[model samples]
Target: MRWLPVLPAETGEEFSREGQPGDAPAGEGLLSEGACDEHSVRADVEAAAGAGIDRRVYFEVFGCQMNKLDAELMLGVLNENGYQLTDHPSSAGVILYNTCAIREQAENRFFSKLGHLKKLKGERPDLVIGVLGCGAQNHQHDIFRRYPHVGIVCGPGEFLRLPQLIDEARSQGQVAALDLDTPVRFERKENLGPRPRHAFVSVMRGCDMACTYCVVPRTRGPEVSRPVNEIIEEATVLAASGVKEITLLGQTVNSYGKRLAPGRRIGLQHVLYGLNQIDGLERIHFITSHPRFMNPDLIEAIGSLEKVCEYLHLPVQSGSDTVLRRMLRSYTMDHYRKVIDQCREQVPGIALATDLIVGFCGETDEEFAETVKLVEEVRFNGAYIFKYSERPGTSAAADLQDDVPEEVKRERNQVLLGIQKRISLEANSESIGQETEVLVESLSKKDKTRWSGRNRKHQIVVFPSQGDEDLVGDLVTVKVTEVTPVVLVGERPGKGS
Candidate 1:
């Protein structure tokens, strides 16, 4: 839940979108002139640590897996710079909220939380409050004006300047580090918080596709893929440190290595091949793929690779071609079906998941019915169904009318959820009596006696632990016995009747 920010690059002058020196806003002071020294910021933080000041930071992250990885990396940097993470915001010297601007619900939740923090800030005047990620990038200086208690506002790209921004915000009145021009790197030497059995490795950042209702391209900037060598090295380090599974994080993960040189342009398939060679890694996964980029090579890699799990989370926002055109999703229903058909053909029994936005600008009931029909035909393992919420600055919000009534949107959302629920239940029922491999993650939250893990298909399988042995990272064979729409109840192979 806690997150960290990036260290600022050593640059005395701030640059505008045009890459020219820009004047700081009058009231906002924007990190003070010439205060972007990374070394000085580190020294100040180190001195603060030496002085026994509370370097505890309470970080609450909102949004997707990419944001989670961002938080992890920033936490590593903060940890390196003499900051400690605390769960309790009141006890911490700093409180940071890594926000999401994608959904209206997420934004509302953040503002509500920020409102609650006003009393806390009033009590502790020195409590350095910061906002990071998409919301920070989208709102920027406006956040400071609205929430005067906020000392720092950093975008996703400018995380490298986090430590420096925090230091500057403490010394100066207010500081803003909103720069989306620079490519955000995902390398960190140290691991923050607990060293879990699984981790997320961000292979790429941002998105090139301009979906009308989405805010990723605006919030995260353009797509930038990390070098193959760098990704392999990061995964290697993670495997060596006891990580068994790693989900490659990106906006559109399948489009990795598109911008790299011809010699180094190996794409995501090659990245999988490299990770498959790592000694300790048990499983590999990537998420939120684009249907357009689900090429044959990537599909072959998923089928062929030993470590790569057989699961795909491809989001088909809508089923209607007209809606798809308006949404600017590029691919049509037929193309999406073809992609799914190819995936199933290549990797038999591959569990498939997707994202669905029920109501968009001018979605019709007939279009909604087509989505329901697609769900019935595909029968995905799971689907993240959401009602469309207009995002400001997006093309849909600017150009199109949010004509779909809220009641209609809600009805359509429930309809899809119902269909997917039945499909999921049926799929899980089919798995009963079959043996599957599960990487034990932790003890079940509801039942202390049982252990929980995910199979290669990314299905949640729970089995009773042989209390004598620890199975946190071990791959155990489980015989599926019972199932629900969302979970699978299984037991150790021979033990299950």
Candidate 2:
């Protein structure tokens, strides 16, 4: 039940739009940054091994599940280097803001939290306030310009330099953001915590899409997929560590490896084949896919790999081709419907979720109706609906017009959501009285007696615990006794499959 900030549409406008395809900045920024400056990671690894640095460091995480996993990875890197993690931001010597920049609202929230860190620093002047991840990458110069107290601005690629960055930030009061394309794959990075049933493995950094409503290609830089061998190695490590489920992370996950050697590159298919070979891995899932690049081979992998979960989240943005064309989504309604048909054929009973935008510039009532009609045809299990907002310095902001009235946008959003509610309820009703396996995440905060987890289709299931003294991270089976549009209330049926 932890709150994940799905920023208000006004804040995330640019991120939802469309951008140029097959456009990648080819260059040497890949893997250029080393472990340590003036010194090498080998020497620091030795010294860090021998040093008695605190193993317990307090960590603060902000933004998406990807950032949460990055926090996990950063913790892994530090723990491997003999650093401990602490929960309190005030007591810890290192205070890191695991950041996000996909939306202005998130950036504002991070700075609001940073205000607290600065106050803590006022009490202890030597405290290290370091920022990392997408927000750091997106607003590197701007962040420093406003907050001189920030000691370090490390991007998503700079976690490998944690030991070094911490050292310099402690001494010099500043660390440069790792320039975009600096390859610092924590790919082989260890997981410091206990082997959970579910884990996240980031497969790519940055995205090239300029969806007029998105800031990713700029914030995280061009599309860069991790090497397949590296991903398998990491998956093997996770397998050894007891991770049963893995979700491949990326802005456009299906577009994995398209940038790596161009036409000769091994894509997500090769990557999936490698993962299916790993021992002890149970279920796999990936997300935030662009409908344009999720190729047939990747679809085949989802069908062929039993360990791969039976859920797919391909964000359609808008169902109307006119709206999509304006958004520059590049794919047509017929094309998306075809992909849906193809996927349903391959993975029978696979549940589908999507990100939807209701109101965009020049959208008419007919266009809106087209979106609603398409949603009904797709019968999506879930859909995240959004309205458009003008972002600063984007193509949409420059060339296009934001002609839709706010009231009209709200009405369209409500109509779309109203339709989705019925579809989701129907979808959930279809599962009533059926038993399914779920990965138990935690007890529902609303009622501690009810445990919650997601099924293979990514449907949220809440079941009565029966006072069996269960803990989080255990896989269990529950029978769907009742349902809502979004939640499935059930009871423990037996052990997992």
Candidate 3:
């Protein structure tokens, strides 16, 4: 097992003292006053080993579905090594946070929760705390300095080394495996024990695009596509274990095979073709596609594949060419429109979703208006709108001035959100009285009598449970009875229609 060199421990002191008098604010200081004393650390580990310490881990995931899959794989590894999972942090002997560094808000929320864990760590000195994923890669040793109680810091690429890192942290102090240079490997085991109906399979890692307002390149490194055979084999295992649907994950998913070797340079369409052949898998989906790579071959595959859903999540940061140039998106408004036109032409009634960032650096009123016009023209089935948050280590933060005032950014965000809400409501309203196939996922959080699932277009459909029949994982026909901006309320077709 590979381990990063441990940070030298302070001599002759307990490892629990987190902060000292007149130290820099909560997350800035070096090693705490009494942390990582070699003899004491060994004693703690030996004592815990002698007592047969509880191996319950509380794992919390943040950010995208990609992070969730990483946590799932890591948990599977831990389970193989005699560790069990727990929902409550207070009851667990180990706590892991799989964090994201996509937006500033996510980072802030993670720090707030990490602060809360300080009290928990103080109470249980033997408890092991770990920080994983993108945030760990971005913050590295700085996380250890800020929160000395953090036992391990492993990046996304180094997740397979987590068990070894945890043991090292217990014996030494503050072990980090933040090596983004290494390629990420996915295990073929079934990891989604809780959600067996659906799973996320990461087909590729990292991004080669130099979008100015993004941090993915810095956190995840350059593009590296997993071999096509590996993905197929993983999906096959998932299907055999009762996963009905699989969503391929990547930073730029549609650009999967661009970095592979020439002989094995099969694109996402080829992978989708292979997965579609799996007997037990019912649905196939890929997310967060880039316009530059959504080639005709992929579009044709989506239209023709029996298992691929008629849904696309293509993010267009801005609709103005000037803003696109500034953001280094490498696509123009006209080019994006052409791609949308192609999808609509190829697959009729396709549900479209997008991500839009408002009030980017130096965004003029006219540019914002162009974005509004594009939204009106496109009328996406769903949209996720956000005010652009300047991320450190990106070109926008280093060079471009965040000239858009906070209130203006907020106003632009609201304007786009209101437009999308109206459009979404109208789109869903049209679905009323239409019968669609839904893959039941689970019981509704609002009411136990109802079950929640998604249609082929990726629209949420909620229907009542009939008698004692367990509808989970079943594809049932639901007649749309009512509609909201976000969900479609429905019932079994014969009973309601």
Backbone clash total, candidate 3: 0
1 versus 2: better lDDT goes to: 1
What is the clash tally of candidate 2? 24
Candidate 3: segments with Cα more than 4 A from true spot: 1-54, 263-265
lDDT of 2 by residue, 1-497 (tens): 11122111112111122111112110000111100001001001112233233333555555554666666677667766777554455446676777755444445666877776666777777777788886787677777787877888998777667878888888897887667767756564455332246667888877777777665566667778888888899899988877777878777788888757767967887878888888888778885577888778889899989888888877787778888888877899999999999999999998887777766889899988888888889998776665666554556778799888989988887788688788888888988989988777666646666776677887777777665676566777788988877777777765321
What TM-score does each of the candidates earn?
0.88, 0.83, 0.88
CA error at residue 293 for candidate 2, angstroms:
1.6
Q: What are the Cα lDDT values of the candidates?
A: 0.73, 0.67, 0.74
Q: On TM-score, who's better, 1 or 2?
A: 1
Rank candidates by TM-score, best first.
Answer: 1, 3, 2
Q: Residue 254, candidate 3: how far off, in angstroms?
A: 0.6
lDDT of 3 by residue, 305-392 (tens): 9899998878787889999899899889888999999999998898887767788899999999999999999998876665777777
Local error of candidate 2 at residue 381 (angstroms): 0.3
lDDT, candidate 1, at 164: 90
